[model samples]
Target: MCGGDFMSKNPEEAMDFLSYVADVSRGWDEPTKGEVGKMKSQLNAYNAKAGM
Candidate 1:
C-alpha cells in the first residue's frame, strides 16, 4: 500500500511505457476521474517501469 510497492519492477514482467495524461473533461472516469487514477493503473500494469 505504498508508492514504492507500486513503483517496483518485476523481472518476469514485460516492460511497458506508461504515458502520463490527464482526463478532466467530466465523464472520463475509468473507476476514477483525472490522471491520478489512470497513472496508477498504468504503473501497476507496467510494474512501474521508468522512462515513462
Candidate 2:
C-alpha cells in the first residue's frame, strides 16, 4: 500500500481492467512478449498484494 490506496484499490477491478487492455491492445497491434509479460507481472504483483 505504498502511499496508501494507489490507482485501483480493488483487485478484481484491476484484473478486469488489465484483461480488457490486453484484449483491446491485441486489436490495435500484436503485443510483444515483453509487453504481455509486463502486464502479467503487474497482475501477479497486485494479486499477491491483495492476497488473491
Candidate 3:
C-alpha cells in the first residue's frame, strides 16, 4: 500500500509500481504465490485505470 495514492493519481507511477511488484514477485517462493496473485490483481486495476 506504499504508493496507493500516488498510483491512483499517476498512471505512469502506477505502471512502474506494478512492474516493480511483478519483478520482485518473480523471485518469490511458492508460499508467496498468493501475494503474487494479489499483485496481479493490482496490476489489472492499474491497467484498467490507465486504459491499457
Candidate 4:
C-alpha cells in the first residue's frame, strides 16, 4: 500500500475531497450505508484501471 495509491493527481485537493466524502458517507446508516459503500467500492475499480 502506498500513499500514492489513494492520493489523487493533486495531493492537497484530493485529501480535501476525500475528507468531504468521508464526512458525508459516515452519516449514512444500515441499508443506505451498504448501498453507498457498494457504489464507493465500484469506484475503487478506477484504481486498478489507472494501474495503481
List, residue by residue over 1-52, the lDDT tens digit for candidate 4: 2256664447887777788878877876545777889888878888778887
Q: Order the candidates by TM-score, highest first.
A: 2, 3, 4, 1
Better of 3 and 4 by lDDT: 3
Evaluate all candidate structures by whole-model CA lDDT and list the values in order: 0.50, 0.77, 0.79, 0.72
* TM-score of every model versus the real structure: 0.27, 0.42, 0.42, 0.39
What tens digits encode model 2's per-residue C-alpha lDDT throughout 1-52? Answer: 1244447458886677778778877877776898999999999999999999
Best of the candidates, lDDT: 3
Per-residue lDDT, model 3, residue 33, is: 73
Give the winner by TM-score: 2 or 3.
2
Selected candidate, larger lDDT, 2 vs 4? 2
Better of 1 and 4 by lDDT: 4
* Model 3 lDDT tens row, 1-52: 4444763557877788788888888877554778889999999999999999
- Clashing pairs for predicted structure model 4, backbone only: none
Whichever of 1 and 2 has more TM-score, that candidate is 2
Ranking by lDDT: 3, 2, 4, 1
Candidate 1 residue runs with Cα over 4 Å from true position: 1-33, 48-52
How far in Å is the alpha carbon of 19 misplaced in model 1? 31
Off by over 4 Å in 4: 1-9, 30-52
Backbone clashes under 3 angstroms, per model: 0, 0, 0, 0
Q: Write the per-residue lDDT of candidate 1 for residues 14-48, one digit (tens) a residue.
A: 13312222324344554446577888888887875
Candidate 2 positional error at 48, Å: 0.4
**In terms of TM-score, which candidate is strongest?**
2
